[model samples]
Each structure stands twice: as C-alpha cells, then as structure tokens.
Target: MNGKTSVVKHRFDIKLARSMFGAISFGMALTTSAFAFDPLLTHGAIPMSPAAPLFANTGSGVCVFDSMPTPLTLNEAIERALCNNPKTREAWAQVKIRAAEVGIGRAAYLPTVSAQWRGVRDETTTNVTNYPQYSSNYRNSVLRTESVTLNWVLYDFGGRAAALQNANSLLEAAQASQEAALDDAFGAVSKDFYSAQGARGAVDAQKEIVAAAQQTFDAAKARADKGVAPISDQLQAQTTLAQAQLDETKAEGELATAIGTLNGDMGMEPNTALAMPPVDAGVKPDAMFQETVDALIETAKASYPSIRAAQSQLDAAQAKVRQTRAEGLPKLQFVAEYSHNNQPTTLAVGIPQFPATGHEWYLGLQVTIPIFEGFVRNYQIREAHAQADYQHEVLREAQIKVASDVWSAYQTLQTATASLVSNEALIEISRKSYEVSGHRYEKGVGNILELLSGLQAYARARVSWIRAVNEWRSARLQLAAKIGRIPSR
Candidate 1:
C-alpha cells in the first residue's frame, strides 16, 4: 500500500511540474503574440502609410507591356511614361521612404514594450579542503526567468511634436517633388511625340517632291528623245530626281530616330516599333495666353510643385531647429517592468535541493535632465538654423525660376503662333511656282534650272511649315506645364 502511495505522489509531482512549465510557456507566447508578432510589425516593422495605396504593386513586379495601341495618342504616351518610366518609379520610392519616416516619428509618441525569456541548466560542485567528509558535493538544477518591460515618454517639452512636424513637412515635400518630376516627364513625352509626328510629316513632303522631280525628269527625257531639247537638260532632271530621293531617305531615317526616342521615353526598348496617329497641327490659339505674363507668373508661384516643395523643405528645416532646441530641455517618462525567476537551491552539503520562485514589478515616472554635453546641442541647433536659412533661399530661387520659365514659354508660344501664318502662305506660293515651272518646262519654254529651283523651294517651304506646326504645339504644352496645370498622374 505504501509503495502504491509513493507512486501516486510521484505522478502528482510530475503532473504539477508539467502544468507549471506549460503555464509559463503559454504566458510568454501570449505576450509575444500580442506585441512582438503584431501584424503592423510584419511589413518591415513600419505602420501602413497613407501613401501606401499609391505605391501598391510597384515592388511586387515590374510593369509589363502586353500590346501597344494601334496608333498611340499623346495622352496615352504620357500615361505610359508616368506608369513605367524609371524616373517616376524612383520618385515614388522617395515618397515611400518619407512616409516611413513619418511613421517612425509617430511611433515615438507610443509606449515601447519588450519581452524576454531565459532558461538555463546549471551544475555546481563544491569542495572543502579542511574537511574531507564534506568534500565533493554536487548540485544540479534548472533556472527559468521571464521579464516584460514598458517605457513611454509622457512629456518631452515639445521635442516629439517638433520631430513629428519635421517628418510631416518632409513627407509633403517628397510628394510635391514627385509631382514636379512627373510633370517634367509628361512635358518630355509630349515634345517627343510631336517631334516624331513632324518627322513623319517631313517624310510625306519629301515623297511629294520626289514625285514632282520624276515628272520633270520624264518630260525632259521625252523632249530630248524627239531632239527638241539637249541631253544636259535630261541629265539635270535625273540628278534632281536622285537628290529628291536622297532627301526622302534622310527624312525617313529622322522619323525612325524620333520614334526610337519616344519609345525609350515610354520605358520601352529603343528599337521598339510604335504606330502613331498624325498630329492635328491646326491648333487654335488659347485664350489662357491672353492673360498678362505677370498674372501667369503669380499663378505659377502660388501652385507650382517646385515652389511648394521648396516651401515644405523650409518648413521642415525650421521644425528641425525647434526639435534641436527641445532636445536640450528636460524630459519626463513613464517606465514599468515585471520579472519572474525560478530555480532550485541547496543550503548545505547532503541537503536536498528546494525549488524557489520569485517575482518583481515596478511602475514609476522618470525625469531626465540634460546637462552639458560638450556643447553638442548648441552646435546642432546652430546647424539647424543655418539649414533653415538655406532652404529659405531655395524657396526664393524656385519662385524666380518659375517666373522665368513662364515668361520664356509664353514668348515662345507667341512666336510659334505667328510663324504658322507665314509658313502656310509661303507653302502656297512655293507650290504654285513649282507647278507653273513644271508646266513651262513640259511646253519647252522653261529651263531645267528654273524648274529645279522651284521644286527645292517648295520642299523647303513644306518642311518649314511642318516645323512651325510642331513648334506651336510644343510651346503650348510647355506653357501649360509651366503654369502647373499639367496632371502628372
């Protein structure tokens, strides 16, 4: 009966030990699951930023182009550039980085919680030199400890607020800078698209000249065969035809180059082929340009992304100065900690070990006063002030530059608009002259030189007209961009 009782007691002790260990392990797991393993800590330990949606799937995979439009339009090209260009992606990344910084600054206002768990298998041996009877005693035990600590800054004399404000301002600056970058890309793609269309138009003009040259060559050859004209006339006509063909070939090459540039700007391979619709060169004058240049300048200064970015940078720098000043003041904090330890202890040799468990906890407020730190804080504050001053100048320079850009674009648009009328009239006059000279040569009344001269002049006039149309379109778009009216996204 006694043996059965001893066996029952041993089983009960084993069960009790297992329950204690399970309870401790379960408590530690709960602590970690509630704090350390929170979902917010999964994404690089940063809270989800408000800008997160804008940059979604950017890092998931690179953009793929399945099929291009049959005839890509200017708006489509701008959209592709904004979506796939490396420059836009880089700008988005900058915004994400700033957003993460803002999250970190906000985290400073929250309490920080940490948990620790430790277990050790310890073996000790003791020897008594004077008493051999008490020598060679050994003790074996297990030790377990668990702790959790929480610290929160209750007050910092505005240091945390300043830091958070600095972060917010920088985030604003990054967002504005991104807009500026996208607008620049939009303008670039628009110009390249128009330039490519112009090149195509040039090719068309060259084809017309080539046909006219061939007609002249055929007429001279027919007259020479009938002995009504000299062979030199036929030879000159043939030479003119060859020159016109060469010009056509050159124009085609220019068109190819322009298309390649447009492809590259759209974040595609340079050699990628793209079909583009012919640009409508009959753009009417916009009433927006009728406003005074000074008024436009004022509008741009008020809303231009570059100016806004500069202003935000200045605000961030000023906030940094305030943060630096606040860092030198005293801070108040709240701290709490809880700890537990369990181990086996033996008081003397030949005595069985006894299990001991202990727990400690404390909650209190802490005051941290900053004394002399080798004048580091003073220098930091000075540096911040200097930085603020520099940013102020940057804002001023941005305003000046925006004004200059508006003025230049406005003047360029006006010139391009005026040139369109002259170019159109020149084309008409040159075309009539070419036709008249061709008719006279066919009737054996005009020389080869007069016909060739008229042909060359007409071709030049056509090319000039194409250039004028492209310039007008480009100038208008640039002015709109300068006025901060271009939508990048």
Candidate 2:
C-alpha cells in the first residue's frame, strides 16, 4: 500500500513519441485552410424548400418562369408557398435551436475530461566558490509529464433535472410556434390567392361590359345611317365605348397588382407572371358554420397552436422556477486523475533512464452551499416566479385572442354570405334592366344615357359578386386557422 513498494514498470520510446508528435502536427497543418464556407452561395436549410433534396413535389424553379404559364391549382399553390416562405423556415430554425438546448441541458450530468502534455528543460551555471558542491560548471535536465483529468457533478439538488425539463418544455414551445407560423402562412397565401382570383373575375366582367358597349355603338351607327337617330346619339354611344374600354384597362392593371402580391406571399419574385382562372371556377367548398361560437372557442382554446405554445412556455417558466430555487441549494462533485512521468538518460550525465506510468484516482463527496450572493440568487428566484406568472397571464391572453379571432372570422363569413345573396339579386335586376334598356334604345324609345346607366349598374353588380365570393372564402381560411385546422386541407 506504500508508494515505493507499489512501483510499476514503464517504457519511454523517444523515437516513437517523436514520430507520433510529428504525424499529429503534420495532419493538423494539412487540414488548416484559408477559405471559409459561404452560406449565401449554397442552398440553405429552408423548412420545405423545393431545392431540399428530401422534398418530393416540384415547383416552378422559384419564379424562373419568364411569362405566365398554366394556372396553378389551389393545392399546388399552397404547397409551394409552404415550402418557400421565409417565416415558416425561420420558425423551423427556432425549433432546431431549442432542440440543441435540450442536449446542452442533458450534458450537465456528464463528466468533463481534459488531457495535458508538458515538457520542460532546466539549465543553471555556478561559480568556482560552489565548485566543490557541484562538480559540473553547468547543469541541465529534461522532464516530460502527461496527465488525464476528470470532474463530474455527482449531485446538484435537482437543478439539472429542472434544467432538463425546462429545455424539453422550450423545445415543445418552439415546435408549437412552428405550427403557428405554418398556419399563418396558410391564411396569408389563401387570402392573396383569392384576392387575385377576385381581380381576375372583375377583369372578365369588365370585358363583358366592353363587348356590350361595342354592340350599343354599332346599333347607334346603324340607326344614324338609316336617318332614325341624330349624329349626337352616335357620338354618345362612341364615348360610352371609349369609357368602357378604359375601365377594362384599369381592371387589368389591378389584376396584375393582385397577382404580384400573391407571388410575393409565396416567396417568389414579384415580377413573375402567375395567372389564374376566375373566382367562380376556383371556389372552395362552402361548408356552413353549423357549430356555435362557444364550441368553436372551446376548440380553439384546446387545440389552437398559439394556445398550445403559450401553455408550453408556461411549463418552461415553471421549470425555470425550480431551477432557480435550486441555485441557492447545495451541490456535490467528484474528481480523479491519471498521470505518466518520464526522465530519460542524458549523454552528458551518463545517468540511467527512469520512466514510470501510474494511475491516480480521487473520489470524494464535495459540497457547495451558497451563503451570501449579493441577493442575486434571491433576485433570480423572484424573477423566475415573475416570469412564471407572466407566462400564465400570456396563456390566458392567447386563449382569449383565439376566441375573439374565431368570433370575428365567423361574423365576417356570415356578412360575406349575406352580401352574396344581395349581390345575386342585384345582378339579376341589373341584367333585366340592361336588356330592357337595349331594346328601348334600338326601337328609338329610350335615350343613350339610360342605356349607359343600366350597363354601369350591371358591371358594378358583377364586380361585387366576385369580391363577395373571395371575401367569404378568405374568411373561412381565417376561421380554420384560428381553430388549428389549416393543415387539414
């Protein structure tokens, strides 16, 4: 059990040591480089990017189209937007970062290992007065030692456990946040798409008005030639035709703007031309809102991503309270080490080599209890308590907002539906009036002004019908998102 009696044999091969050292140095030198990686030059970690090799669906090469091609179906448009949208990707990144935090929290339980290699040379010179004490005028010696050390936190009064739980809760919160971002993206894309469709519908209606105006102009010219109408009547018809054409041009411009906005929402180039059919053709399924507002609000409180995210944050804050409380408690740790020492023979001293390899271990319970911390530990506990309370309030607010959003969206849908019915009636009445006015003018019984009035009223009714359909569709998307049903589509 004594030191000298427990000597162990060891070998020191200087040649082998030199070669190993040279190899390691050479390898590290070869691996070193001046060039740095550029993230901007390559494809990044987009959540569902089309460029992602794991993705299966195809997109239009991120707005590579020089001109408008075939219209995209609703499903295709939603898929593309989900893939390329920046907000979705950003939320996805947050999830990943929080997941890494979970790993960091778990790491607190593991031991920290460190190794060191040290070599030293000592030289000294003495005068003749001390020549009898030291026969040599100069003395030199070399020593090399290597050691491996470890430190492990044996216990921490539940601090590590609380931290791990906090990390897990944060990760869940991040995941819920990601889902919320996706829901938001879906709502935005749907609104933009339907708005574009509405604009296209308006353009088509304007074209019909222009065609009717052309017909009126031809009839006026015919009557004037037959001496049944004055030249002023023909001029009036021509002016109507000119104004109708201008209206059609303006509608086309507005349609272009809406299409650009939709493309931007999809994370594509704004200038990319994307065409779509009229709103009627792309009308989504109109399911009636049979559920009461209370049921819908309850569903939102339970299932909405925002609500789930807030709940997760509250859990994380509670864990943080535990972690902070433990900070003022006692902790325990363990320490151990292994070492090797070599003293090689020197040509000048004619001394024999003395090299030894040994193992050393230190095992004990270490305790650390905080005494005076400038009230920092107390402040941390209080702050965590405050944060927990704040998170609870935030969760309540999130639920309230979810219910409010659902109610608002429901009201909007109802209003849009009622407006659709009223618009339909208006369109029917305006169509009949236009027909009667056309007949009267052809028979020389009504003036050009009355015919023009009927035409304008019909055009307005048609535009309103198109917008009402889009508004209702957009409202449905909003409600579905509020209730966490966006991915159902």
Candidate 3:
C-alpha cells in the first residue's frame, strides 16, 4: 500500500508540473505578440490609429446608404453630410498621419539592430633569403565573417520625451480641427436644406401670382370683346400674362438650383433629386439668443473648436521648442555586438601554414555631445522659438475672431427675430389688399392698372415673407454654431 501511494503521488506531481508549464508557454506567446513590430507606411502595416479613441474615421462613404428620407429633416441632412463629406474624411486622414508621427517619436526610444557580412580571397607570395640561397613560397586564402550589432538609446536628457509630447499635442490639435470641420458641415447642411424649402415656397407663391395675372388678363380681354375697353388694354393685359409666365419659369429654375445646391452640400451628385419639406412657417425666438453680446462672445471664446485647436497648436509649438533645445544636449546609448571570422589556411615560402577562426563579443556605452555643427543647432533652436511665437499670435487672433463671430451672429439673430413680426403683418395686409382688388375687378368697379399693381405688391410680399423666414432660420443656425450647439436637432 505504501509503494502504491508513492507512485500515485508522483503521477499527481507530474500532472501539476505539465499544467504550469503549459500556462507559462501561453503567457510567453502573448508577451511576444505584444512586442511584434510592423511598418507604419505600408498597407501591410498594423493599424495604429485605433490607439486614439477620440479621432476615428466616422464616415460611411458614398456607396452604401439607403435612400434619403423623403421630406428629409434638417437633422438628417446634417447627419448625411457628416457621413459623406470629403472635407470631413480629409480631416480624419490628417489625424491618422499625426498618429503615425507619434509612433515615429516613440521609435526613438527603442533599439536599432543591423547585420553585416564580409568575404575575401587573397593570394600571397613571400621570399626568404639565406647567406647563399633564396626560396619562395606562395599561398591562397579565403576569409569570411558575419556580425550583428545593436544600438539602444538609454537616455537623451528629455529630447525623446519632448518629441513624443509634441507629436501627441499635434494629434490633439488635429482632433480639434476635426470637430471644427464637423461644425461647419452641420451649419452648411442646415442653411442649404432650409434654403431649398424657401425656394419651394417662392415657387408656390409665383404659381399663385401667375393665376392672378391670368385672371386680370381674362377680364381685360372680355371687356375688349364686349367693346367696353380699348384694344390697347387687351394688348397690355397680354403683355402682363407673358411677364407672369416668365416669372414663373424663373422661380421654377431657382427651385431646381436650390435642390442641386442642397444635394451638393449633402455630398451627393449635383443632380440628385431631393425633397425638401417645409418647416412650420412661424418664427419663434430661441431663448439661447437672449444673452448679451459680451456674454455670447465670452461663451464662444471658451467653446469654439477653432480656438481650442489653436491652443493645441500653441502647445505643440512649445513642445517643439523644448525638443529643439534638447537637441543641443548630450546623448547616451548602449551598444552590443557579436563578430565571427573564419579563414581556412595561410602559407608562404619557407614558412609554416596557419589556420585561424576568431569570435568576439562586446558591450559598451556611447556618449554624443554636440560640440559644434556650423551653428546649425543654434539656428534650429531659434527657428523653433520663432514658430512658437507665431503660434502664440495665431492663438490670440483666433480668440479675437471667435469673439467677433459670436457678436455678429447674435446681432443677426436679433434683427431676424424682430423682422419676423413686421413680415407677418406685411403678408396679412398685402393679402387683404389683393383680395379686395380682385373682387372689385370681378364686379367691374376696379381699374385694371390698380388691380395689377395690387397683384404685384401682394406677390412681392409673399416672396419677401419667404426671404424673412430664410434669414431667421439661417441666423439661428449661425448663432448655434458660434455657441457650439450647431448639431442640435
């Protein structure tokens, strides 16, 4: 029983050791995979952009999409633009390039490995002289060697660190630029989408004007036929009809143009058909616009992406200065090498033959101090300082522009909101005048000239109403963008 127990215990120990060994092997594989390297500039390279969660390509491109929603909403138009716009894609690509720069900066902290090989063949002859005799010897020899060497930077007095920091700051600036691009895209899509609706509204108004003109022409013609009006009046009425028809044609063309423009903004083919359903006609004041101009300016200074991007750029430029300054400092590195040499044989006249093989290993530290280089390092540092100063000025200018934009957008919004009330009243009064004039003409008590004048004024008022609504909508979007709320539905 004791011998059986011993054998069983030994088997259990073997099983435990095998399990632990397997686990260790698995962990080693994972660690090796973690260190695997790939090229950065090739299609075969592993992607590094995913390391940055904030800046990823979000577009779905132009090929894969369902039909644009019928009577598409403004929010949907902005979304479509975000997914399809080439400008947005270009900005995202810029971020990827900056991300690659980060990898390049990091590589300065790693080792460089290189290999070398050499082969040689030699023919030699030697003469030996004695008191009364001379002898000669000749030999042929082959030599070969192979070696691999490594150089690793162990310290750089913060040069590598500064470069890495600069790369990261540039990447962050690119991300902020992307956000600004998205803001512009949203504002553009909203403005054009609403403008298309305004065009449609103008077309409908022209249609009504055409009908009214036709009625006036018919009245004039009937009076002429009954010998109650002169032929010149009928001629004038026919001219008015022709003019009205021309206006209708122009209005229809404008509608088509607006549609094409909207499609282009949505990153579709220019001729793609788009349905722009009108929003509700009344203009309402947005409470967000109630802030004072100074307040709005302050808000924009904090929220605008342009300002943020400029700030990031300034930071990158400062980091660049640090990197340049450190370039003049000393560098320290560790180096290791292995060399092997083989030569079969060497012989000469009156001498012995020799065979040789040599192997060597070396490890050492190398230091590089920048003593002088035609003042190049100094110039580099100066150039970096200049760039940093320029970035600072740029950041200052951006802040001023942000404030100006917010102020202008707020003024536009206030003007548009105030005009809405007056515009609505104009539409009501003009509409009433048109109805009265048309009714009197039907009863034969209205002058045709006065009736035509009223018709023109009424049509103008309707068109003006559409323009007013456009201004109001556009101003709201512009203000929203200035306040960092442009993507709102």
Compare the candidates by TM-score and give the number of the best one.
Answer: 1
- Quote each prediction's TM-score: 0.84, 0.81, 0.78
> Which is the leading candidate under lDDT?
1
Off by over 4 Å in 1: 1-66, 126-141, 279-285, 346-353, 487-489
- For model 1, what is the error of residue 65's alpha carbon versus the real structure, in angstroms, after optimal superposition? 5.9
For candidate 2, lDDT tens digit of each residue in 1-489?
Answer: 111212223333344577578879976775663123322221132234422221224443532333334786655566577767888777877876786677778778889898877665534333223233322333234467778888899888899999989988998887788788878887888888888888888899889999999998999889889988888878988998999899999999999999898888777788887778667675554664668888888988998888899999999999999999987888888877888776443343223334444545566666788888899998999999999999999999998889899999878878887888788899999999999999999878998889888988888888888888888788888888788765334
Alpha-carbon lDDT of model 1: 0.81
Query: Weakest 10 consecutive residues, lDDT, candidate 1?
Result: 4-13
Candidates by lDDT, descending order: 1, 2, 3
Q: Candidate 3 lDDT, tens digit per residue, 1-489?
A: 111111111111123466568778987997887446444432222123321122234432322457778787776677677666787767768776787788888788889998776655544434333311223343434456889999998988899999988988888788778778777776787788778888888888888888888888988899889988777767877887888889889988998998898888777888988777764643455575777888778888887888988998999999999998888899999999999987545353334557778899999999999887899988988999999999999999999888888888888888988887688899899889988987886777877777777888888888888888888988898888777765245
State each candidate's clash count.
0, 0, 1
Ranking by TM-score: 1, 2, 3
The lDDT per prediction is 0.81, 0.76, 0.75
Clashing pairs in 1: none
Clashing residue pairs for model 3: 137-349
